[model samples]
Target: MKNLIAATYAPMHTDGSLNTDKIKDYSQFLTKNNVSGVFMNGSTGDFTSLTIDERKAITLAWSENKSKDLYLIDHVGDPSLKVAKELAQYASDKVDAIAAIAPFYFRLNSIDKLIDYCKEIAICAPNLPFYYYHIPVLSGAQLNMASFLEQAKDNIPNLAGIKFTNNDLIDYGHCKSKANSKYNILFGYDELFINSLPLGATGWVGSTYNHLAPLYYKIKELFENGNMEAAADLQSKAIKFVELLNSKGGFNGVGKGFMRVLGVDCGPSRFPHTTLSDSDYIEIKEALDGIGLKSWFSK
Candidate 1:
């Protein structure tokens, strides 16, 4: 659960069918690159683009490839509480942990409501740990997680921590400092992993971890060695890498395609997610090299 945890993309064949065949290789690829965990079926995995059966197949695939080195945290969030519960129950025995975001359709209006939503889902997997995926920009449930911890701490018995995916560093710091530092506040702003260090964050979950793990580890190493200038420089380059492709189109799809440059093709993105041509990637690679990030690509 600590260190870099990749929010993996769902591998698909050209026909847009689930290609669970590559799950093991994906796991090994991540492990070889120094990634410690895989956070599956999250936003990066294009969960919203998948059907219930396909999602189930993904869970089964990852579960079968589960290893001691790669901790799996399945994001079981769905707009329907019933569906989220089903997903939670389905992933209960399969993953190392389970997480759910607030129901986005009618989004939970209060911290209490969110707690209630999480409690039901957590109870479904009573034996396993539960994480609340707090990404307000997407879910529209922008409550203070510090307050969430105050109210939810005792209520949800298995509330392991949060997949904190926002830039409210103030509230994030509060969550980190809450209740004698009881919860595992996994920082989610990939571009701001440098900022999290000052706040005492050790774990992070992000999609870019899939591409730039070794680079991040080097950043961590440099920072811990008192080379703030070098660490911040690399961190800024990483941020630039995201901005570069994000400028071309949307980042999610472009970034997913960049996985192939590192020798693992995650395949074409689904509808609304643009898949780049090999030439597009080649051009992007040239752009990456221009910024002195050629060596950072995951291998």
Candidate 2:
């Protein structure tokens, strides 16, 4: 769990259907790239766009490839608590862990409401570790996470920790210190990877890990060797990777297409995400090469 975990993409066919068949190859690709685990049905996986059955199918597909090396975590968060519980139950035995975000449609106004929501869903998968996906920007549940952990520790039985996605380092620092430093607070803001290291972040979950696992490992290596300057330089290069893809379209859409360039054809993204053409990849590859990133791409 100290290694990078990839927030995977939902592979789709040309007709925009689930391509579960591709998941086996996708798993192998992640393993080859040295990604230690996967956060499936996550934001990067486009969980909102997928049906409950499709999300269940993804959990099942990834389960087949689950090994000691490649951990699997299913994001079963839906606006409907009933639906979230169902998905969590479905993934309980299949995945290594389960995570859920606060109800996005009707946001939880208070920390107590958020805790109650997590408690209900966490119980459905009582046997598995539960993680709160705290991406307030998207979920609109901007409650302080440190406070949530303090109160939630007594309420939720299997509360492992949080997937802290927000950029608020102050809140993150507080969350990290809660419960006498017991919770497994996985840092989610990838662009600020270096910012997290000084505060003692060992594990990470992000979309960029899918493309640049080696690059991140290099960044960590440089940082640990007391070379702050080189580490920051490499970190900038990683951010450039995100910015470059985001420039083409949204990072979620364009970044998925770049997987094909790495030899794992994840196919096109679903509706509302841009699908790149062969020419687009050609240009993308050339631009990335110009930025000195080609040599650092995941193997």
lDDT of 1 at 167: 95
Residues 130-175 of candidate 2: C-alpha lDDT, one tens digit per residue: 9999999999998999999989988998999899999999999888
- Against the hidden reference, what TM-scores do the models get? 0.98, 0.98
Off by over 4 Å in 2: 179-181
Error of 2 at 108 (Å): 1.0
Q: Write the per-residue lDDT of candidate 1 for residues 1-299, one digit (tens) a residue.
A: 68999999999888888889988889999999889999999999999999988998999999999888999999999999999999999998899999999998897889989999999999999988899999999999989999999999889999899999999999999998894657888999999999999888899999999988988999999989999999999999999998998987788999888888888878989989889899999999999999999898788
Off by over 4 Å in 1: 179-181
Model 1 TM-score? 0.98
RMSD of 1: 0.9
lDDT of each: 0.91, 0.92
